[model samples]
Target: MGFHTFDVDRADALEDPGRYRFCSREELVAALDIGDGAVVADIGSGTGFYTNEIAPFAGRVYAVDVQSEMHELHRKKGAPENVEFVAAEASAMPFDDDELDVAFSTMTYHEFASDASLEELARVVQPGGRVVTLDWSANGTGDDGPPVDERFALADCVDAFESAGFRTVDATGRKETFVHTARR
Candidate 1:
């Protein structure tokens, strides 16, 4: 299904505030180890949460989402000079191969329509570029989070990335969060 039906305005309404508090933009960015002059892409960057934080550290950031309303919200929020909003599907990013130094998606991989999204992510990053993912931990218990089946387990995510030609570098579970860092 296309992402046009996604309600950008009500996106956060689907989330549990208390559970997401630990996955705050500040904490996620710090964990990324983002370097100066890095080029990054925040796929499924709803509302520019992670995009806004990483923009300052990176030379350029591509905030990509399929929904126009989502991109509209990101634009209205006024991203930094280094950030550019793009309307594109997660499985078909409009970026050249080896163009980005880092690619990140927060609470988004599970929402991807299929495995194509993982292929697209691996295609865009340089051979040594890193891919970082933070999503709901599958153990559940988060404050009123999405149904258990809708969430992607950390192991499944890692396997998908590895199958897409990414090498798993780290995997950790903290609080209600699952973080994975990999290299393409």
Candidate 2:
């Protein structure tokens, strides 16, 4: 199972520009490298921050969040035409098998990381599909985002994905976070 969830009261902070210090929009999008008209899901999407950023590039984007309040908050912000909010947990999504061309999450991997969740990801993403994850790293200094103890190290993430039968396309641990791309 995953760790504690983010407080919905801090949903406003999800839109803060300072968040780029951990993972920028460009980096996340580039890591996904989806083709035009690709179906994607933003797992654990909170306030649709990164979801909105990648919306224009996708044919459809499912903003999957466990908290309906986050979806309501994002709805108030006006979701992109292609974005649809789905109230679902990472371990149990409503998507069909091989439904998504890509699935990505920013800073929320720790909240949902589990064998079941990774298996669910492998089931949802199609063969040759991509899964991009950018989050606070366990190997980082306690400077920002979640505490290091609660975060997963790059190796742990890589092993988890591989164990889930996905191929690691790219993985890098930065100063305060790690970005990983896995191909199903």
Candidate 3:
């Protein structure tokens, strides 16, 4: 795992619509490039913000998070018909090998990023499946999101995923964030 988990007390901030300026739903959905029936997992799926957005396009979506309270919060907020909540850490998920068609994380990669997590993702995602990550970049100024010192640069993400046997598909370092898609 990475430096720190998000504080549940401030989780309401996660639902802010203004966040779309950094990562719009259209951008994320396009980045995922999933079929309508894809089995997906939203790692660190906080309040199900992005999970709800992707649920309509997926056959099943596992909202994975380490915090049980986060699941409860999402449950109270309501989930789509195809959504299921799983309280688990990123490094140790319960899916069978190659079970997921795709898995993606938004803004939470800094919290669950590790060699073990990347390897686990490689194990769970089917061959040719994708893992998409968008998170605050170390290259950004310390103006928003996590402090710069706590964030990882795009190169670090690419190196870690490549080391875990994933092939990089797309990687772009934007102004305040980075998005990387890797194939398992």
Question: Model 3 off-target regions past 4 Å?
Answer: 1-3
User: What tens digits encode model 3's per-residue C-alpha lDDT throughout 83-137?
Assistant: 9999988999999999999999999999988988998999999999999999999
Q: How well does each candidate superpose onto the true structure, as a TM-score? A: 0.87, 0.98, 0.98
Q: Model 1 over residues 1-184: C-alpha lDDT tens digits?
A: 2133346668665343554465776777766667789899987888886688788888999988877788777777678999888888888988998898998878776667357888888888989888888876777675644556667678887888898999999988765668899998
Residue 176, candidate 3: Cα error in Å is: 0.5
Off by over 4 Å in 1: 1-6, 11-20
Q: Where is model 2 more than 4 Å wrong at Cα?
A: none
Which 10-residue window in model 3 sums to the lowest lDDT? Answer: 1-10
Sorted on lDDT, highest at the top, how do the candidates line up? Answer: 3, 2, 1
lDDT of candidate 2 over 71-92, digit per residue (tens) = 9999999999999999988989
With a 3 Å backbone cut-off (N, CA, C), the pairs that clash in candidate 2 are none
Report lDDT (CA) for all predictions. 0.77, 0.92, 0.94
Candidate 1 global TM-score: 0.87
Error of 3 at 112 (Å): 0.8
Clash tally, candidates in order? 0, 0, 0
